[model samples]
Target: MIREKSKERLVISEFFKPFLRILQIFSCYSPVPASSTAYKMYSVVEVTLLIFVPCFLKTVDVLQSFTELDEALATLLIYVTFFIYTLKSISLITQKDDVRKLVRCLDLDIFQPRNTRQRNFIKGQILTSKGILTLFTAGGCFTCTLLDLQPLLINRQERNGPINFWYPVVNTTKSPAYEIAYAYESIVSITHAFTHCVLDAINIICMAFIIGQLHSIEDTLINLRSYAEKEVNIKGEPNTTEKIHVQMNILLIECVSKHRALRRFANDLNKIYTNNFFLILANCMLALAFLMYKMSKAATLDFTFIFMIFYFGTMMTLVFMCNWYGNEIIYKSGNLHTAAYSMDWPGTPISFQKNLLFTIIHLQVPIKLYALNFFLLCLESYISVVKTSWSYFVMLTTVSNN
Candidate 1:
């Protein structure tokens, strides 16, 4: 058991090395115990001061900007984004144990590929996850850079910080205060981007892994008969038929067990992230709406236009990925019943046939992830989000014109 556990840890660590490194840097994942002072201090500094405080001030600014429609919308975008950052940070800190449980729940024994073919599939999925994460991080940094440089693009007299924060005591409109505020906002803003990327990476990568496992199960079921035949042929026993039936039963049982484990993992994931998903969907809708309206008013070559473009594109990708993986899970799991039916069970023993029937019935319903039990995280929800954003944008434009 110890050896098996050690191997599991090793495999998981190697698989997630890149993501884990970035997560640690942001204090989202720590090697040390969560109860340790060092870990607590690091998390506090990274999350409380950097995320919560800024988000609070940004919320204040969002309320204050209400008097001016354009200003309010602009500040509201940042506020929405920062709100997500704050929620993500707080969740990470407060639900430390739950997060750990989620991580460990990806039991290597269940997820690890048994064959070279499955191994190659898993490898490709890992590479794809890493590539997506890298792109997300790079894009986030690039967006932050564009935002931090926004004030520089304008005249010095009109200069302001990237964030429209309502500082408690400091008069940030003056020369030195303005510069200080700009620097602080830039740092926090960049950190927010990184935190966003890291959390999304964790969720999306997990979903990717689940999708890969589902594919492996499907493949196994589809090829179950051939696999059993090969095993029987290799043995060359007197009771070849009985051996084949036994082998089929064994493989079928393993697949059923793995599938159930995958379902449990998916449920745990939904519990951990459903609230966050609700917030993300809500925020993205408002942000994308206002961003579109604002971009329409700005000159094509202006800094504001360019900045909104980057921000808009980033949000689109984030929303798309969340829904895409979710939809993939549903689609893949939905195919499991078909795969089981495809298994050449016609000639098998009545016992084997009965087991296959049970498995098929169990897999009838496709697996799904949801937001507050209202929004199913799939392409359909993606379309709904986009449409809602468009409606909000239209409303804003009408209100502004009046």
Candidate 2:
């Protein structure tokens, strides 16, 4: 158990080690799904076989019946959804440790109130970097959903011609029945896409934070290690005080060393969040789009299929979000531990960090990598926008051709 008391006479080990240990718990999980590594391989194999067997049967059973077709399709959706979901889970485990190690590397102390300016700087960096990124991704997902669903609704209105049938539900006619019947379903699809997108965005936001945290950790560790090595060489003669100093220096070094490995695990967690979240959203939308175009094309009077997709989507999203939050609590707690461990250096004023950025850019951040990743992420997002634009253009062309 790690304590978060300011008055607590700053035990650096108590603070840093415990929290770090707790965080590693999330990073180390095998992608294979079971608690045991021995059966882990078997678990993956079993899942693969199970999914494959059904898919194989489906291939053979394609001509069986609509029931078979429906079941097979749903199974495929489930398989893809869970498979990607697992990868995301694994990635997050890896990302969070990367962050923790980087932080341990920087060795920021949450328990010590020293370095007020530096503390604020790092805090600002975290909020703006991760928080803002999260918000941006969330907004983008929402906008995409609205735009995608608009086409569906517009098409519904076009094919149906008029809203007259809905006006006379009790005395309905097939003439305008198709459009009116699907209204409910279309509304559902719109809501479902909207819901799923938000969740997906949130997942990405988590990853972005994990990335930022990693940057912070790495900066701290490198500087502290260099400072420790310099101390031993400076102290010349072998005496009791020098020996004690050496031992403490070694302890600090070990903390950074041990932390490096554990933090890598933390970073893995963030990666999982980014990849899994997007995959979930994309897969769900694809499945919904297919159903809307196929099964709901005729007999359906309103948008029932869209609604079902949205309804299930909202429920699933909440479940995944809760899972992420559960894991993060361990990470934040671990960080608190690392901060306590670094408090042993009483002479080192915490304020040394505000100058840290000016003192050393590498320790402050890998600006080159930051710029590269940020640009790459933005480019990927832009590509999606372009793809959507082209898709819209093609649809317009085909409609004109028809």
TM-scores for all candidates: the values are 0.93, 0.34
Q: Give me candidate 1's TM-score against the actual structure.
A: 0.93
Q: Write the residue-wise lDDT of candidate 2 on 81-179 in tens digits.
A: 434444544454446544443434334443232233323433444455345434433443453354345435756545432111123233333545555
Task: State the displacement of the C-alpha of residue 367, model 2, in Å, after optimal TM-score superposition.
Answer: 17
Q: What is the lDDT of candidate 1?
A: 0.81
| Candidate 1 residue-wise lDDT, 161-241, digit = tens | 887689888888887988889999999888788778877777788788888889889978998977777666656655477
Candidate 2: residue 114 lDDT (0-100): 23
Worst 10 residues of 2 by lDDT: 364-373
User: What is candidate 1's CA lDDT for residue 371?
Assistant: 85
* Reference-based lDDT, each prediction: 0.81, 0.38
TM-score of 2: 0.34
| Candidate 2 segments exceeding 4 Å error | 1-122, 129-183, 201-206, 225-251, 254-261, 267-402
